[model samples]
Target: MMIFEKVKSAIDMKTVAEGYGLHIDRGGMTLCPFHNEKTPSAKIYGDNFHCFGCGEHHDVIGFTQKLFQLNKPIDFVKKLNTDSGLNIDIEKTPTKTDISEYQKRVNEQKTYREYEKNAWQILCDYLWLMREWKKRIPASPDDDLDGRFVYALHHFDYAE
Candidate 1:
């Protein structure tokens, strides 16, 4: 149960291999650093990882030893846990990257709100201009200035 919790705490799988100076590719897979490898044969799963080339399959502890060439798995695990600052929260929230994405969405929403506000202001200005123009123009018998102003205001209210 302790190992399980430790493994769970070590969420970043790349941290193990990176500690050993091994580079993981963008796909979260890396070439077998245990031996010379022409192509990447390591497969990183959500809970565990395995290297097809060297047949190295273990939990976080096993991974640290093989990757770091250490004699003791426990020492490797402890060192890695401490070095990487493993967060062992039972009820962990999403990472800062997720929060940054949410912030980006909020900024986009604010941009849209500003656009909507500008559009509403333009529409109100256009209505005011039309009312002034109507007053200056000679009114025909059929022209109803009161009715037009009421209709435009009603439309603006509905937009809000």
Candidate 2:
């Protein structure tokens, strides 16, 4: 089984919350840790927790990730195994290098999208400028302004 599934099945959210010093009542209500609240607004179900005060809801794994500020599931599972004595294998898990490479690719794609958007906006502005120049120039065939506007349009097209 995957580490996430294994750890999730072995661990109980209420027990983990209590271990973290949260007082859970009989109705599965506790003070929200994500936000300050005088009344109990966090509800702990069988393997999940929901905080009404903070509008945060998460399963056991998500709860652990948030509570400990962990960014990876493997780290959360490892912590659970060390702290709660739950054995979960980590041999087949993806390495940090793979995750970093994926993140880099995503960032590159976002940059390219931004570049494309800017290029499109520049093209639109140039087109609008050309239309406005046409309106300002006289109807005579020999108008220097018309030639200059055409030259500007041609330059912008080549630059793009």
User: Against the true structure, whose lDDT is highest?
Assistant: 2
TM-score of 1: 0.45
What C-alpha lDDT, on a 0 to 100 scale, does residue 146 get in candidate 1?
A: 71
Q: 1-160 in candidate 2: lDDT tens per residue?
A: 5667656665678756765678888899999888888999999998899998889998878887898989877787788656654433456664556445534544564467569869999988877776665455556876556665666656655644
Candidate lDDT (C-alpha), each? 0.61, 0.72
Off by over 4 Å in 2: 92-160
Each model's TM-score, in the order given?
A: 0.45, 0.54
Question: How many pairs collide in each candidate, listed in order?
Answer: 0, 0
Lowest-lDDT window of 10 residues in candidate 2? 98-107
How far off is residue 131 in model 1, in Å? 59
Give per-residue CA lDDT, model 1, range 35-108, as digits (tens): 78888998776556788887878766667666667786566666655554453332445465644553454456
> RMSD of candidate 2 to the true fold?
15.2
